[model samples]
Target: MDESVRFDPKSPLFVNDPHGMLSILRERHPVLWGGEARALSGRVFSVWHLFSYADVGAALKDARLMREIRHVLTDEELGRAVPIPEEFQTLVNSQRNMMLFRDPPDHTRLRTLVNKAFTPRMVERLASHIQDIATDLLEPWPAGQRFDLVQEFAFPLPVIVIAELLGVPKADRDRIKSWSRIFTQVLDVEVSLETLVRGNQMTKDFRDYFRDLIAERRRNPQQDLISNLIQVTDDDGGQLSLEELLDMGILLLVAGHETTRNLIANAAWIMCRMPGLADALRRQPDLVPGAIEEVLRLEPPVMLTSRFLAEDLSIQGTAMKRGDEVSLWLAAANRDPAVFAEPDAFRPDRSPNRHLAFGQGIHYCLGAPLARQEGAIALKTLLTRYPRLTLAEADLTWTASTTFRSLTALEVETSAAPQ
Candidate 1:
């Protein structure tokens, strides 16, 4: 409702071409302002968008604001939003219990349980494994031939690594993928009733599968993440509840796979467009780390985060009353001119990169190390193996997930007469 904020709900700029709108918001109104936000179904939600690095970072730093909004759902709102049947809530709740939805003490406890599993040392170990996985997947891609990187590498790499960590058989990855796709649909702001129904079934199916797996792990424990989690307990000798474990499983599967998939695809697509940067990486592989940082800055996979104003607070000269919705336009913030010089240009070796692609404050991404490792290995391996890479097709299409930004397919011609 600010006087300077302007929005065009009917314009295609609001829908298919939001980056253009975002550029306008960044240039003109970089703080709280009105704009058209889109749903998964391409429906527009009139939202007061913020594009400034300072404003967006401040919003994310607000601990009072809750990120996940399922807890405050009313019966009517839940019905319209999630579309899951009422009877299924308890079952869904059991299978999908993670720290992501909780607050304070509960979140503290849940995160404590899982945090140890993702320590820097553990991530380093996983990084080595990730490198091997990336190499194996990349080997078969007929160097000079065209292939979908998302299908062959990006999507499968993290899924396989996470699956292996969970003691999930490689044979079961397809099932995990199916369940993950359905589970993700339910997270969409606008989901089909049919998708909700199918998602409910997928949740149940995932829970049941994990239930059986846990039972087996209990009997014959293996040296895997699940076994490790089962062995650990609280001071009261209370183990992770069945619900907690199931949700963690779901979280690891989806979070482990989806984000990295997008990161890989998006980074690859961006690099393809910026041939000089890719050439730079090929020439000086040491710059791969810098390139990864730049990728995180420019086209972060998890682009948007939602926060609710927990109490009346004024920020950026705007009154934020309790219960007001605040959208953290992280993708927009990463490109804010105030933060990065030449923010839009793809520049590897760009020093002092403090982009919040992994977020900030207490709720930062737990898998930051793993994601970075996966990206570095994936990009480095591609360049090392082929030495030459080119986009096989122009006008790359993007995936339709609002929260996760990635290429639908990146058709690349590798081994193109090595530069």
Candidate 2:
């Protein structure tokens, strides 16, 4: 296990079966510090990866670890050596403005402006529509045959839900999937130059499309999140600028689509192996929500999130310097035995589940409630539509990413007539 600590995040060993390796790392080296400079996009920085639940949870709440270092560190003080690629500037700038990448006042301001759109009441209003979309997608499937669940249902269900929520046309949802995928991929600790360049171009394309939509919403306000975002303001009359608005739209698309898609696929995959679980869910539909939580705990969508130190600090008697990057492994923490009983076991009704799937503190995912609701609805729909299911193959492959834990494709067979 000690020798396996050097394993790369994108390697086949980690992607396919990371839990077994992660459990060992958590037990042995919870605070595994890299003893060298790590380069991301040609820029170098020291990094420390936190694997234990205690360390990850505490670090997430610590204000000293800031999301946007620019808020405190000046360009001269930081002394950046490599300039960002010309093409990647749009993507970088958009990320910088997004609430996901901001700290304190900016993050608070941006999250506050859109908080109303994600409240329980708001998400509940869309429940019927989500179910309808799921039903519509499943209606065309051929019974007693093998098909790709991700391609047929899991992928498109959330896209349609979020698209309508954002007031975008259903026809246009297909175009933004690649843009969102590229955005999540480039968020890794190290990404290819080509990936960055491609992501930047897609960023520009989506920005252009969103620009027209924003303008149209301003012209004719509608009953949708986009119109609300354009017109609504905080208590202090704070409104999002054109750049901020565009970035917010991009962030919503990425957050809403990717996580929910994986959540549904992962839940279905787990159920296929659990004997009589499908009948249990159908008999007791209320178990679907609890089952979803168990899935989130066992396999989170976002693996790890990074924060930079605002000032020099020490943790667990380990000396750390200012500006050092800390990667909090949420996937590792969610599976830590110190917190969960039989952390690896798939117990659908596991109570008091305190999984940090959506993270914690100021940077907690804003779309969490919506994502959970979408997951529950999607799973229930899948269970109703397909009474019998089995994995298309035994060996499964995940996407090539360290940031996202997603299936490359989930092929499921429901070789029974649709219920």
Candidate 3:
């Protein structure tokens, strides 16, 4: 433990070039014990950063480490830290019930019910539909003109697809997108009171909207996921409760698109910087999947995820006590030299590429197949249609978030219209 290697989560250097800081941490302090700091509302919090690939991988699957919020903070502590008014108990309860924040038996049960909906076969069936959406979104962009790709394409593509999949009415998509953005702030390590309040309101809005949708689905089921989930039964022959259904809807609506949206935007930014990469993909459409994987490895949407020690554990001789939060730098792990040769280089054809972008073990991302399909189709369609795409702006602004590594806007231009 190097007492001098203190990590500031909000440092501009950390946010702008995390891979560089991660390299220093991996080499010097693979398992750094970052002492206490005031994060949420003056509540002191401690963090342990696991930077090395082997350490992070082991910590991810270690039963001694847990993701449930209760392991890190009590209900009272959470309430105090977030400081939501008593009137918003429903909001708090709904957040607490999210499958991402639950431990097993509950995690197992919730995952089991939703597993059938996201199988590779089911996601593959939507490929053509995804391509259609990409075409529809791109058709409106004028040839030889600048357009904000984040607003025009990256964000809407996934939101529209997920909303349609969930059977959400097309008219409600704008409101849903707004709510989804507000709600995602809760995932950040440093959140403001305003953000928390906005999140509560967003949760209430989602619950109200989904309640009616769930009832409609119950009365008149359709050929969509919400309808299927309404009738989905666990092995014990139990269906999702009203609250569970609502939470699931919110989760899918938000998580389904947020990361994928970033994935597409990041891929586009990378392509614009790497000359001829897009043209290469245009020449060989078969490389799209590998290109998407490379983008994920290089610029993962979600940079870090946290887990708390369920019991005292030691990693590479760094002792950690129970209840200490471990921040797994997934972005760091993805570029680990031990696993990846030329860790900093972007090689789409890098075989045996095993990145932790989707995570591992039971808590692996549920929408991975869907995200991959969307990424492949979205990037391939864009490059194939516009063979001469380039960045319209040199100064790009990234989203101000600790969890998500995303651009606020991506302006791009094409030399000509689709052939």
Q: Give the whole-model CA lDDT for all candidates, comma-separated.
A: 0.74, 0.84, 0.84
Q: lDDT by residue for model 2 over 1-419, one digit each (tens)?
A: 13345746668888888888888878888877754564433445667878889999999999999988776466766666557669798888888888989887888988898895556687889989998998888888755778888888888888788889999976787787777778777777677889889889989999999999999999998888898888878898888888888999989988888888889888888877874887899889999899999889888988889899898888766777787888899999999999999898877789899899999999898888888888999899888777788898887889877877899788887866534
Query: What is the lDDT for 349 in model 1?
Result: 69
Model 1 lDDT on a 0 to 1 scale: 0.74
lDDT of candidate 3 over 87-159, digit per residue (tens): 5566668877888878887988999998865566768788899999999999987567779999999999999
Model 1 agreement with the true structure over 175-250: per-residue lDDT tens digits: 9987877776666545576777777778788989998999999999997888877777766665678778888888
Clashing pairs in 2: none
**Over 4 Å off, model 2:** 1-5, 38-43, 80-82, 417-419
Give the clashing pairs for model 1: none
RMSD values for the candidates in order, in angstroms, are 4.1, 2.2, 2.5
What would the TM-score be for candidate 2 when compared with the true structure?
0.95
Please give the range of 10 consecutive residues that has the lowest summed lDDT in model 3: 37-46
Candidate 1: deviation at residue 71, Å? 7.5
Backbone collision tally, model 2:
0
Clashing pairs in 3: none
Q: What TM-score number comes out for model 3?
A: 0.94
Quote each prediction's TM-score.
Answer: 0.88, 0.95, 0.94
